[model samples]
Target: MNLLKKVTALLLSLAIVIGSIFVGTKTNSYAATSKSYIKELKIGKTYYYNLDGGKYKDKIKVYVSKNDNLLLRINDKTIKVLKYDYEYSKHNYNRLPYKCNVRIYNFNKKDKSLEIVLNYREDLQEGYRILKFKNSKCLLDKIYNDSYMEKYDSNTGAITLSEGNWGLFKDFTDAIGRFGCYYKIQIKGYKIYNPYTSNTTEDARKFKYTADKNLNAYTNTNSSKIAFTVKRDEKVNIYSFYQKGNKKYIKVKNSSGKYGYIKIGSSPLFEEWLMVR
Candidate 1:
């Protein structure tokens, strides 16, 4: 009977130890999974809370549940319970309505950084609606026209153009339209000179001049000292020009395919300094 009692006690002890180990493992696993969700969040990028169990690095299937909460960190500061009680499915995780407000700083300059804040709720039934924060405006705006251009001046921080006139623009838009065709600047009457040739004028003749592929050119007079050529009948956008003494240098391209700044003149074929809108 004593032996039997001893065996029973050992079994009970083992069971208790196993239970404690199981509980500890479960807690650790939960912490690990939760930590993964909050890792590598950019300061100003918005992220939705996903309740489904999945990895965070890639697109993960998530299912929303009422008990799920999102942990957020901004500017190295921990923010707990930014979003709560959100439910989602793996396929429709992004459709769920818990959203954070993200702002991009210095987007015009080279140093672009993000700042994010949680100030909105996602309503799946009603689509996404932005909840305006105190003194904050909505980020997204509707398109007013089919073709539009907006220009901002860095010098004065003033918006100059909503549409019309490329000359008023400081920078060119990189997007292409459906037609896949646009305008460019064309240059004429520019002379190419070679500094190395003994007969400078004659040597200039020897260097076969060609237009650049993009139908643009740079000037030899600038600090860059780069000469670009352009092909004939090709279009290019014109920016600023360089001027020295009595000569004004305009950026252009040649018929043979080269791009750079060229001197403009009244030659019949190379008559007009033209820019396509």
Candidate 2:
């Protein structure tokens, strides 16, 4: 009996020894093989980078220079993709290079797919573009358009356009409508938001803020609410202002021009959601 127990102990010890060797070798192997492809370059308060961001960097030079206009360099191919919001940009923001950062948004080796999000600084996303690559080449360069971005429909995860029954969906987007063909694009990282209800300008106060929250229009300054629950994305006009205790509230008119009291921060202090000529 004692001999059998000793044999069992020996076997257990040998198994543990083998396990440790396997784990130790794996750790060292991974340490030796693992690599990072992104490099950050900062100049004063500004930032730039060089990225092995998948296909774009596979056979060419891919990096961002410290120029105020963020220049994306791919070999001899350079594109001015982003510009900080300057005074001149305000008048022609739509016509200028969008605000963006230099980074690897995505990469995949098995599928040979690479995706990138050009995050623009403005609240309006109509100017942004997402670059998609397949098999070491660019497959699609899609810009943000109302008709297409809304199709995402609150799907904040990676989605591909390859498998779709879009029918005549091309009629909506600004992209050249190509029937019987679809490009693969990863749509998860784009910062999607409704332009009607949310503030879009860099200076929130400079732009007319809208009602982003579902609020109750009370009969008076009291906590009691009326029958109306101000609908989402509806225009709110301040009829008057009032203060109760340490809190401030506003008397606002709904879409029907019906006056009721709404809690402070529910309506904009400036113009409406869209500037009225």
Candidate 3:
């Protein structure tokens, strides 16, 4: 009986030793895997490109979000990285060739190198409105002063406005009023906001306008009949507009729910008669 008890105790000890060895091996393996994954991905961290011996390399700051979305900040402008169709690396780590507007930057994990490719113009999608500013210096000069000039798509007959242009147009027309000479342009399909600000498109069909002086609303572009009379300092909402023989006409609705057409112009004193609100 004594010998059998001793043998049983020895077997139990051996079994406990084996179980510990297996558990230790599994724990170590798991720990190693976790460490490697942490090293591979550093989400929400800003990374600098100082690996290459290039001037002005540190000027660009890149950040990757928790969702693996990359963003770049250059010249005080933040550009979001977009997926593009281009081969970058042999391993294609996170799909290297990423597009940021007119420039494409590729990242390689193996050598930790960044490659920047620049293009003169951006690739425009269909149905983008190309603004041909009519004789206004501020609006016209924006085309050249901007980082990337709007591109005209010959096939679509539209111009691709940059993200900066969207903000500029919105601020000029809605917030800060255009000065010196009034800006006049033919409204197209629909108006869009800054993509970063709002995901939904604005019901921009009607833009607010204030009457500087009392004016008569015409029944039609060519008709002598009057539909209504807009009072001075009265506010109206513009629904549509058109150009006719050196004059521009806007279809508007007054606070009284009365709809009529008002004429607008490009004269220096045009804002005194009517201004966009």
Candidate 4:
């Protein structure tokens, strides 16, 4: 009887230990599977998401750049998604990366916070409904259509584009009508109620540099499409840095005064082929 009792106690203890381990593993798996929205978007990171409230069952892989340009890989094809607002872009026809001007106005004195507005010069997304969300929950808000008008308030919210008459099929070449594609974008990394401004001047003299070797400059971030080439020790003006997957590219203007992207090496060798000015 004593031996049996001891065996029973040992078995119970082992079961408890195993149960704890099982519970821990389950918890970790659940935590890992928790989906993150666009607000958590980071450069050089890929996000897995579904479209139209999961109405489309296909899992899409999204890649974002510092400028909020999105690349979606679905059904074994890559699609370029640009922002609805692209008034500032002058020369670029294939507008992958979207640009918008964000400004704060103290127009309404009744409200404690300053009024935030997004200015768009283009009429491409005129009637499109802007779905605003707070903490991943949808919020009923009004978005005014004006070049310079008070639209949003100083609040951290996710702005998503809902399906309208002007669908992504017009912009994307893959005929995105079947996928119910909607853009999930948010304003982040910008200080609210602060005077923030981005210089849009075509002056490349600000961040000028010289190529250490003969490098091929592409029209887009993908090194496949060579727009131009920079000879060794040729001077170029770098506008900004963009990331596509693990590769980095600098938007630069070669000596010919044409804008293009040059592949800057990854990590430690990012500036290996460039002589910084």
Q: Evaluate residue 223 in candidate 3 and report its C-alpha lDDT on the 0 to 100 scale.
A: 79
Model 1, span 123-154: residue lDDT tens: 32111111111112222221111111123222
- Measured with C-alpha atoms, the lDDT of residue 21 in candidate 4 is 24
Q: Compared to the true structure, candidate 3 yields what TM-score?
A: 0.30
| Model 3, span 108-131: residue lDDT tens | 233332333222223221111121
Error of 3 at 103 (Å): 9.4
As a whole number from 0 to 100, the lDDT of residue 212 in candidate 3 is 54
RMSD in angstroms, candidate 2?
24.2
- Write the residue-wise lDDT of candidate 4 on 1-277 in tens digits: 2676446534533443343222212122122211121233332344443322333433334354455454333334434342422333533566534344332333322322222233333434332223222222333233433111112222443333322213322221111111111232343322212111111112222333445467888988754988987886566665544443455555677768899876655222212121110
Which is the better candidate, 1 or 3, if ranked by TM-score?
3
Give, for candidate 2, the lowest lDDT window spanning 10 residues: 196-205
List model 2 lDDT by residue over 1-277, tens digit each. 2676446534533443343222212122122211122332222232222223343343223344444344443334334343443334545655655344433433333343334445344432222355654343454555543211212212333322211112212221111111111222334332222121111111111221244456678887765868477765555544333433445555566767677766554333322221211
TM-scores of all predicted structures: 0.19, 0.28, 0.30, 0.28
Question: What's the distance in Å from true for residue 81, model 2?
Answer: 4.3
Ranking by TM-score: 3, 4, 2, 1
Please report the TM-score between candidate 4 and the true structure: 0.28
Segments in model 2 whose C-alpha atoms lie over 4 Å from true places:
1-69, 77-99, 107-110, 123-128, 133-137, 145-277
- Candidate 1 lDDT (Cα, 0 to 1): 0.27
lDDT of 2 at 186: 38
Ranking of all candidate structures by their lDDT, best first: 4, 2, 3, 1
